[model samples]
Target: MRTQVAIIGAGPAGLLLGQLLHAAGIDNVILEQRSGDYVLSRIRAGVLESGTVRLLDAVGAGARLHAEGLPHDGFDLLFDGARHRIDLAGLSGKHVTVYGQTEVTRDLMELRAGQGALTVYEAEKVALHDFDGDAPYVTYLDRGEQKRLDCDFIAGCDGYHGVSRASVPSRALKTFERVYPFGWLGLLADVPPVSHELIYAGEERGFALCSMRSNSRSRYYLQCALNERVDDWSDERFWAELRRRLDPATAEALVTGPSLEKSLAPLRSFVAEPMRFGRLFLAGDAAHIVPPTGAKGLNLAASDVHYLSEALREHYAERSSAGIDAYSTRALARVWKAERFSWWLTGLMHHFPDHDGFGGRIQQAERAYLISSPAAMTALAENYVGLPF
Candidate 1:
């Protein structure tokens, strides 16, 4: 098979990149190791930054999102049992939309199906071949048969564990990573959200987040030991922790439903230098990953595709590789900025047991300063809400 771009992985990054390139009359193929059902049903990031929303809207992918997603003007920062609302709208004139990653994947999958784009799922041994050479290929096993796909370029939109990053030479790539001492045990419930806005709680026990997926369903998370097991947490135990973190003032009827899903995500900060190497380019989690505290994962993936798509479009239009050549440096600038923000947010909200009283005091002072100073607040709001691509 041949295409202008052979994209590895059918995640949001690859799907959106294909869509953007398709609109610009570029040919691309997406390969995935999982079935379409698994890809669409995977529980992932829910929050979408303003820039992401606009990009989806521009591509006609926001119709369902606009109708079904909840828009919040701001979020609440809870500390010492006090709630401080950061007016996202008032601060940046932009708001975030609460729609699950599954929904976005479903929407894009439907769109791609209708268009008859080349998408192969449940493929195995998906490896990038000759990525350092001018003619790079993607070799995978489809239906027990090995297939080789030749393309002008290869995009590694696969997640952290995928083969894209591994294809790069260790000497050429500089890896930076910081793993947190804690992880988040996220839960999806059938109950309505306890609050109107997303609530981020910083307590002595740990950090907690109250977010919504829909009017009837709520998504919540609590910080726990990095090695904690989901089997250790019972339904009653989960609610107890949530109640303590959320601390509902009134006796609102709290109904506990069967947890549709639960998982532990270890917090970490990672970035690989030079997102591009020869004809192979990396995007999304393949290039960088941020702790989920700032809700930047999905948006960061979208931002990468937005920039890469534009670069590829320019390459096709002008028949110049300048845009493609500069892809890594351009994308890394934004990637690092987001990395700092995610790290800062995670450090401020999460209580590290190893940190002493002075460390806690420093975090508190930072949060206080963020809320008090307009410049600091604006910076937070700008990064949280998102910047224009």
Candidate 2:
């Protein structure tokens, strides 16, 4: 079988790309190593930048999102036993929506299906061949038989551990990574969030985030040791610790319940240069990763897909190679800015193991200045709402 574009991975990145390409009358097929149920069951980040919501709207996938998703103008930052609200909309003239990545993927899948893009799930041993040459093809096992898909271009939308980046030779790839000393132990429950908008708390002990999947379902996280085990913490214990980190007024209003899901995720920032290599172009987690501190993982992925789709569409429409040729440069310019923002937010919110008395005082002073200064708040607001594509 042959197509114009072959997308690897059925995550939001691949699904969104397929939707865009298919809408432009380009033929594309998506391959996934996991089952459809598994893909939808995996919970991910919920905050969607305005740009991301607009992208979904581009492919007619924002109806449910606009209906059920919560829109926020600002969030509270708790520090030194006080709450400082950063007005995202007021400062940046933009806002974000609280919508799960899973829901986005589901909507994209439906849009893709109607637009003539086929997504083949449960594919095994997926591999790309001859991507650096004129023609590229993918091979995988469907049940017990080998299947091949020949295509003009291959898109690596798979996550960091996926085969796309690994397929590149070490000599041609340059990777940068920084692993934080701590992780986030998160608990999800059906209880209402303590606050209407998210709360990002920085305390003497550590950092904690109060977020939500919806008005009734809360997702909270606390910074913890990298080696900590989720099994070691119980529902009662997790709630007690979380309350200890929050400000008094916020903590008093918090509701506790049996957790529906509990897990620990380590913090890290990673990026691979030159997202494009020949016929194979990498997007999303396949090319870069950011700490969740600033809620950039999914947002960055959307931006990558946006650039990629435009390049592919331009190439197919006017037979112009300008967008395709500049894809890597253009995408990386935005990727690096996001990387810096995520890193900065992580540092400002989390206490490092090596933080000394001087370091603590410096952080306190910085927070004080930021809270008192309008310029500082605007800078933070613009980055949070997301910069333009």
Candidate 3:
């Protein structure tokens, strides 16, 4: 098989890239080791920055998002038995759309199918070859048959543990990471959220986030020890624990129900430097990861796609390698800024196991100052709404 670009992974990053490339008259094929249904089944965070929403619109995947996605002008930060609102729109002239990542992927997938794009699901044992040279290709097993795909370039959107980043020789890649001591135990239910706007609660007990997929579906999370097991916590126990971390009035308004899904996600910030390696480029989770506190995961991926698609378009249309040569630098600049924000928010919101008395007081003081000072709130709001892409 031959194409202009061979994309690994059919997740949002890969799918979005394919759409943008196709729209620009570039031919690309997406290969995924998982089935389409399996891709849609994975639950993920979905706070869409204004820029991400614009990309979806450009690819004709924003219709359902605009109709059903909830737009929030601000969110409440609860700490020290008080809740303060950060005016994202007023402070930053931008707001975020609350939509599930699964929904975004589904939209992009359906759009790609309607456009007659090729996405080879269940393409097992996928491998890249000669990406560091002038010619690059991919090989994989399809229904027990080996197949090779030749392409002008390769996009590794398969994620952190995927083959793209792993394909790079260890000496060629430099990695940075911070794995938090705690994880988030999250529950998804059909019940309505306690409030229309999301609430981030930082309490003596732990950190808790009240988010939603829709008016009828709510997703909630609690800070948990790394050793905590989902099987050990029933729906009732999860609700009780969440209540303990919320302010009295907010807790009183909480509604509980049977969970649609439950899982524990560890917190971490990671980045693989110089996102490009010859003809092979890494995007999305293949390049970086952020703790969910700042809600930067999917948005960050979208930004990566933005930079990559533009670079590829320039390479094809203008016959220039400048954008491609500069892709890593541009993407990483935004990636590190986001990493810092997510790390800072995670530290401020979650209880550390070994925080000394003085450290706790300092954290408290910072939180108090953030609410009272417009400058601090403005900085939070700007980052929360997203920095310019």
Report the number of the highest-TM-score candidate. Answer: 3
Q: Estimated TM-score per prediction?
A: 0.97, 0.99, 0.99
Per-residue lDDT of model 2, residues 1-389, tens digit only: 99999999999999988888877888999999999899999889899999999999998999999999999999999988999999999999999999988899888877777766688999999999999999999999998689999999999999999999999999999999999999999999999999989999999889999999999999999999999999999999999999999988888999999999999999999999999999999999999999999999999999999999999999999999999999999999999999999998898889888989999888888888899999999999999999999
Give the per-residue lDDT digits (tens) of candidate 3, residues 1-389.
99999999999999999999999999999999999999999999989999999999998999999999999999998998988888899988999999999999999999999999999999999999999999999999999999999999999999988999999999999999999999999999999999999999998899999999999999999999999999999999999999998999999999999999999999999999889999999999999999999999999999998999999999999999999999999999999999999988888888998899998998988898888899999999988988898
Each prediction's number of clashing residue pairs? 0, 0, 0
Q: Give the number of the best model, judged by lDDT.
A: 3
Error in Å for residue 189 of model 1:
0.8
Name the regions of candidate 3 deviating beyond 4 angstroms. none
lDDT by candidate, in order shown: 0.88, 0.93, 0.95
User: Which window of ten consecutive residues has the lowest lDDT sum in model 1?
Assistant: 246-255
- Compute the lDDT of residue 126 as modeled in candidate 2: 97
Please report, as a residue range, the 10-residue window in candidate 3 with the lowest summed lDDT. 341-350
Model 1, 1-389: lDDT tens per residue? 89999999999888988899999999999999999988877898789998888878776789999999999889988887777888888889899999989999888888888899989999899988887888889899999999999998999999999989998889999999999999999999898887878888888889999888998998889999987999999878998887777556711445567798899999899999989998899999999999999998889899899889988999999988888888888888889899999999899888898998899889989988877888887788888988777
